[model samples]
Target: MNEIAVKSNPRRQRLLQRVRMEIHAELEAARLQLQQRADYHPTWDYFLNLLMRPLAPDRLQAEVGPSGETFMQFGTV
Candidate 1:
């Protein structure tokens, strides 16, 4: 469980490097596909926004009120 031991092991290092490479490759593929197909770009944008929402300071502030209560409003059909 030690971080130093995990990084020092040759097998673990290889496994970690392989995993990082695989993730990078997949992201690149997705980017290429998104660029070639413009129709799904909105969907991709929505997905990215959702993924990054938690990290946006303005979004976080808007979602949580001064009393520390979280609220979301939806429009009626």
Candidate 2:
């Protein structure tokens, strides 16, 4: 490849790396802010738990049992 092409590739790669780093930093900041909000607000923690509850294994199994037995239906209740 020509020298200009080679130089341009590395410059483009460096720009991509910087952009990725900036995005990573922004995500980290957002995650930290969410964690801070969750920590400071008991209601936030409870709401997160509520959001996650339906995905819980026992909840899923109880809501829609894995087997024919009715036992699974009572697991989460």
Candidate 3:
């Protein structure tokens, strides 16, 4: 396991989670723009919310789950 995984430090974990969400948002935004979808805002908005959400002790990583009301679903939920 990685050192981060082994130690499970709360502060480091929160920082990692924040960085991960940012990356997800960035990649999803790029993909949506690449696909040339007209209505990418709400999807973009969703990832933005994910990026801004506060860290919870029992936080779960984003997944490729079934989509929300938005037409285009991201690979990372």
**How do the predictions measure up, each by TM-score?**
0.41, 0.39, 0.38
Best candidate according to TM-score:
1
Query: Candidate 2: worst 10 consecutive residues by lDDT?
Result: 56-65
Candidate 2 per-residue lDDT, tens place, 1-77, comes to 24435655887667767776776666556545776863476656666555455544335454533565554333445
Per-residue lDDT for 37-68 in model 3, tens only?
A: 66555556666555444233233554344464
Name every residue pair that clashes in candidate 2: none
For candidate 1, lDDT tens digit of each residue in 22-59?
A: 76676667666775885766667767545445433344
Deviation in angstroms for 23 in model 2? 0.6
Predictions in order: lDDT: 0.61, 0.57, 0.57
Q: What is the lDDT of candidate 2?
A: 0.57
Worst 10 residues of 1 by lDDT: 51-60
Output the lDDT of residue 77, model 3: 42
The residue pairs that clash in candidate 1, if any, are none
Q: Point out where model 2 deviates above 4 Å.
A: 1-8, 38-77
Give candidate 1's whole-model lDDT: 0.61
Badly placed stretches (over 4 Å) of model 1 are 1-5, 39-77
